[model samples]
Target: MDLNLIALIMGIVEGLTEYLPISSTGHLILVGSWLGFTGETAKIFEVFIQLGSILAIAVLYRHRFYSFLTLAQFQKKGLNLLHIFLGILPAAVLGFVFYDWIKTLFSPYVVVFALLAGAILMIAAQLAKRKVTAESLDQLTYRQAFLIGLFQTLALWPGFSRAGATISGGLLLGASYKTAAEFSFLVAVPIMFGTTGFDLIKNLDVLHPQDFGVFAIGFVTAFVVAMLAVVTFLKVLNRLKLIPFAIYRILLAGVLFYYLYF
Candidate 1:
């Protein structure tokens, strides 16, 4: 297949999955594996292309961010900042500490197992009975914010979706479904940017000139698709539950395992 075609497919997949409770990294790794596109450069390309989805979130939530910056809302702003900070801290610390080890587990076998485990957890979260108290992001307490962030650390394993972990965690912590999804998206902005930015700086020299076009195509495609996905997902959030996504994950894992490992 043409490199450009590969980029297009990947970009579409990334955009569609990045914000969903389905793992974007898991899909990327699995898709790349099947496409025979795995290697150091491919890994770097994946990291760099996530910027597209990050941009979508930034654009979609720009108004909320502007509110956070208002002078009169300084106290609320401070609390918001603290919430975001605490939410991302556990992942930052754990990812930095296990960077190399985490990379090693990016293989198909690990992804398959992680997918199954995460799917089970997602289903369990849906089934668990918990009173919903946090109806909005502003209503989230610091402890709940911190715990949600802690749940995000589970996403270091590729098949464990970041959105899934945080959203499920939010549900377990008494947040409404909409509030959980919104917080998951908000926290993703910083986490994706921070990790992708670091990787880009560290690997900039290794990127090839020929690959720049592919990267651009993937990035643009991801951004456009992600924008559409974000809007659609939000609309359906209240009507749908995580069980469907969890089931999809399990089915995907089963198929991939048989095809790749059998």
Candidate 2:
């Protein structure tokens, strides 16, 4: 297959899945498995393009991050960024330790299982109507942020779906759906950025000159599409429920099983 074509497909997958509870990693696994196996180049591409999505997240939430960087100007904004960083810490530690083992899960069958399991959890959360939000309005305590980071680590599994894990973990920990989703997105910035950065640094040897064109195209494509997705998701999420995505996951799982088995 053409490298540009693969980049385009994966870029669309990233843009669409980065926000939704449907695993971006899972889709990338399936797509790459079908098109190109996860070798050095593919792994590099997969990881770096995620940075593009992370860039999108930062842009969409620019105000929050800016206030965080320029903390002296806005005390409240600084605290918000503080909590977000605190929320990211646990996952960063886990990811650094288990990086190689975690990378091996990007396969079609694994992704299928992840999509199915994650969807089921989403369904259950919707059914229960439970709610939990951080008790402190000032800033999330270290404990709360740490717990969310621990939950974020579960997303290391390709099918496990970071959105699914974080959101479900939040619910399990007594968080409201809205809070869970919001926090999940907030914490994702670091994880995605780290993944992209680490992969690029490690795979610099295999990245040929020609690869840059496709990678750049894919990164920009992912950024544009993902920014639009982020805006659209925040808008619709409040008014809508996640059941539709659950059904979509189940259907996707069925398709993956069929493809893998037969």
Candidate 3:
């Protein structure tokens, strides 16, 4: 496949999976490999293009973030900034500490096992009885936020979805599904931005003159598709169960394992 075509397909995959309980990085790695889009440039492309998806969230939730700039509102709420920082801390710290090691685990076999493990975790989270203590994002306590961050650390593994880990943690801590998903999307802004910025700075030399066209295609594709995915996901979440996603992950893992190992 051509590089531009590969970028478009992977961008679509990233947009669709980024906010879902399925791993975007895992899907990108798998799809990129299958499309022969592997290597340093491809990895950097994947990292940088996540900025586009982050922009989707920024655009969609601009009102919420806008309120943070007002002094009166800031005084009353003290900014969810504190909680958001607490939530992203574990993953940020640990991811940086073990960056190289995590990169090594990005192979197809590791991702296969990770997908299976993550599926089981999601299935278990679905089956577990949840008490709706925190029904809204504002109602979530600091402790819950911290715990959710710890859960997010699980996503350092390729196939362990950040949304999945946080949502499961939120559910286990008695948050409603709506609140859990909302919080997941909100917290992802900082995390994605931080990671992407770090990677971009570290690999600035990886860019070539020809890369901009493909990157722009990916960025736009991800932005448009992510908006659609987020809208549709929130609309149907109340009527849907996480079990189906888990089942889909399991099936995907099995298929990949068969082709890779058989």
Candidate 4:
């Protein structure tokens, strides 16, 4: 029950789930509750550690990010900065507007329903038989990006998952699995940074100097673990697609539901 041990466990959970469409925030909320670590400080800790996962994405896709710097490289690679902006705008605006209200919904009950709902959405997206027009990030259009952003607003619910919503939207809108996953990961960096940064600033009073060590432990652990997870997930996604993850989400939801209400 030591704080450091809790930090390590939560860091592992965050790293493993942050990009997997498995709702890392939901997992953290449930896990924190089980660990008896629920409170203002816990929320800030969760937000802080997410930066580590975001850094993992930024590192893994360094080339793509670097391309954003040069006009010729950006155009040659068909990378559109506008697409990223569009993908982030909808959720960013909504999350900012409802920040306090959303924080209050971070309960096990909300997470359970969200998990099942997101699972259903993922399943529907996979089964819906759509054309695959965008096989790669380069082929994605602005409208598709905007639509994915709109879908991302669903993630305002704790367990719906940012990656799940956006990727499912991409699949529904004619993108290949890889393309959707890639774009989801790409947009996640800025969105998470914005949200986490805002939360830290808003809750600065709750932080203590002693907690920095625990935060650092969680941060480094998430960064290293997420680096491995992101690579492995990308490979597995093409072969297995979203169905397996959807099933996992359903099972997880059922278990959590029973645990909570029984």
Candidate 5:
């Protein structure tokens, strides 16, 4: 396949899956493997394109973020920058510590099991009866945010999914689906920016001048597709919820398992 085509395909995959309970990294690894686009360059490309999806979230939630600039908004009783920091803290620490080790796990085999495990977790969280303490993002507590952060560490393993882990954690901690999803999207911005930026800088020597065109194509495509995806997902989240996504993951896992091992 042409490099530009690969970039386009990867951009679509990243944008579609980045914010979903299905893992974007997992999908990228699997797709890249099928396309024979493996190696360090592929890894860097995958990470770099994710910034586009994160940008979409930042844009979609611009007003909410804009509110952070005001002292009065900070003084009000609700979700704030502190909550976002707490949500990001655990994964950020662990990811930085185990960055190299984690990279080695970016295989389709790991993704298959991860997809299955994450699906089970989502299903369990959905079935488990829990009190809804935080129906809105505003009602979320510091402890709950921290616990969600802990769950996010699970995503250090590709295919586990940052959204799946954090959202399930929120569900288990008594937050409603909308609140969990919103919070999950919100916290993704800074964490992804930090991680992707770090990866880009660390791999700057690997980048060729020819790679810029491919990277730019993927980046722009992800941003545009992600904007549409996020909006559509939010509109239907309450009605369809996590179960549907879990089922999709399970089915995908089974297909990949058969393809890989059979």
Candidate 6:
């Protein structure tokens, strides 16, 4: 395979859409199809690029992550970690058990539906925003976290972006936009890292040292791009409304529909 070109394409997509409400997986799949990247390779490319977004959030939120682990924030340090682990457990289980079937569902047309459906949900979330609590994730109950986890499982289906589903779930469950968005970003680290690590293990025999270099380039590129995405999104989100993103989703889906038929 042409590693450099692959790195460049995946890096750009990973950087650009990883933080947005739009399904990053869906965009990668669409880009893959347009570029003729198919089968296992395409899935590998998509999953690997996801690591970039995860790393970006980890770096950007390093202070929060450190505080969450330290004695300063927690009376019982070990217990805090356990809660985080427990929250990640459900998604991990689901990923392992249904991994193959989930990837098989990726298609451009499904992305169109997901984009449109998610937009409608975003609009509804906007309306519902009035009733939501302004509670932070630290104030979140365990039951609420588990509910978000269940909602996250929906993202395993193509088009239902993980961040999109989780954020909407959080909002509906009473978390404010800032809290929901921040926690949603934090949860991504484990999910993406686990996914990338597992794929690397399964493909170890096939991955030569040069493949590692290519992966590194793509990983670094994705990280840089995602950092920018994270920063810009936070700023835009704080000052503006989610209506802009909702509109973007509708417009993108409309374009996809046109492309589908024309």
Query: Cα miss at 52, model 4 (Å)?
Result: 0.4
What lDDT does each candidate get? 0.89, 0.76, 0.85, 0.92, 0.91, 0.74
Candidate 5 ranges beyond 4 A from true positions:
none
lDDT of 1 at 174: 96
Write the residue-wise lDDT of candidate 2 on 1-262 in tens digits: 8778889988888888887888887677777888855787887787778888888888877776676676474443323656777778878887889889877776777888788888887778677755455533233455666677787776777777888878776666666556667778778887777777787787789889888899998898899988888778767865766778888888888878888899
TM of each candidate vs. truth: 0.95, 0.87, 0.95, 0.96, 0.96, 0.85
Q: Write the per-residue lDDT of candidate 4 for residues 12-91, one digit (tens) a residue.
A: 99999999988997789778888999888998999999999999999999998887777775545465788899999999
Q: Write the per-residue lDDT of candidate 6 for residues 115-208, one digit (tens) a residue.
A: 8787777777767735555466677666667777776776776776777777777778787788777777877788778877888678666555
**TM-score result, candidate 4:** 0.96
Residue-level lDDT of model 5, residues 174-216, one tens digit each, is 9999999999999889889998999899999989998999999
lDDT of 1 by residue, 1-262 (tens): 8889999999999999999998898799888978888888888888877999999999999987676566655554334677888999999999889987987887777888888888988898999999998888888989999999999999999888999999999999999998999999989999999889988998888898888999999999999999999899989988888999999999989987887857
Q: Which residue window of length 10 is worst by lDDT in model 4?
A: 70-79
Candidate 4, clashing residue pairs? none
Where model 1 places Cα greater than 4 Å from the true spot, the runs are: 76-79
Count the clashes in each prediction: 0, 3, 0, 0, 0, 0
TM-score of candidate 3 against the unseen true structure: 0.95
Model 3 lDDT per residue over 108-140, tens place: 788788778888887887789877888888888
